[model samples]
Target: MSDGANLRGRFITFEGGEGVGKSTQIRLLESRLRAAGLDVVVTREPGGSQRAETIREYILGGGARALGPMAEALLFSAARIDHIDSLIRPALQAGKWVLCDRFADSTRAYQGANGKLGDDVMQALEQVTLAGVRPDLTLVLDMPPAIGLQRAASRRAAGAPADRFESEGLGFHARLRKAFHQIANAEPRRCVIVNADRTAPEVGADIFRIVDERLGDAAPAPAITR
Candidate 1:
């Protein structure tokens, strides 16, 4: 059901660890796309619209303690269902560019990598949960786990609670970083690794360049069919 369709719009996903600047990059890309007069829909995974946002608080907040790995994965899948139905799929059908912060890749990293669940389990869950949905291009911002954690802590100092994942020790985050790297290595065509240690503007420029390359020298196809 989520097979690539003749999409007039491009689906670009920003993926990364806790503090790798996924939010900043997504905003940068959305702004750039809009500046060019492209129809753009900016959204995020685990939470996007009203209902999904509620689920996000539960999953990311202290409530995660009540949910086991399977439960947690299911909750994410549920949120994604709402996200795609309410946001992603509709925007793609209308030929509006969709810039998403995080997607199924997070599941693989957090649940598959950090959760100690094998790739097979994660892949299977994705198949069933997502109905074969996949991003056209995924920009993964990569950085050291230590640095990312520090950045996350700093950002959350007064914003909100650190949550279960954020509260996790450095070793857990290291595994997450490794998991993201493995995804990039395995899916080179769809996943690009952007070093996030650079200045924000520079990182933004890299993202823009990557999208341009993906869109190619010619105009994008009127319809994108998988």
Candidate 2:
């Protein structure tokens, strides 16, 4: 059902570990796209549609910690199904640029890399859940785990606590960074690594340049068939 008609609009995803400014860069790109008079729909995985948001809440509520990696991946896939059907598919079919904060890559990194997940399981989930919809381009905001964690902790609201993933130790985050690097290396065309340690404006400028250059480039090599 998610294999809607082929789309003309671009699908861009911003991916990174906690507090790597994925949200900030997304805003910058969205603003540029709107200024150029394009229709853009911004959404986030595991929490885009109403049902998906419920899954996000449960997953971040601390109870799901006890659940194994496979169970967690299933929950994320369930949310992704609702999100693609209810929000992502329609936006793409209508020819609106889709900007998502995190997509399947996050699942692969957080649950797959950091947890007990294998590539076979991750790939199969993608084939089923995505149903041939993959990002035209993915911006991987790369940064050290220690720096990112510090930034994330500082950004948290006063009196608020870190989420389950955020509360993870430094070692977990180091591997998470490597996991993202692996994804970028595997899909060179679809993935671009951006240094997230720089100032927000500097990072924003780098992203804007890449968007301008890459968006006008050729389409992503066919990864999933329609």
Please give, for residues 67-100, the per-residue lDDT of candidate 2 as tens digits.
7888999999999999988998888887788999
Top candidate, metric lDDT:
2
Clashing pairs in 1: 4-226, 5-224, 6-224, 7-224
> By TM-score, how accurate is candidate 2?
0.93
> lDDT of candidate 2 vs native?
0.87
| Model 1 ranges off by over 4 Å | 1-3, 157-159, 216-226
Cα RMSDs, all models: 3.5, 4.7
Candidate 2 regions exceeding 4 Å error are: 2-5, 217-226
lDDT of 1 by residue, 112-139 (tens): 7787778788877887766645688999
> How much is 52 displaced in model 2, in angstroms?
0.2
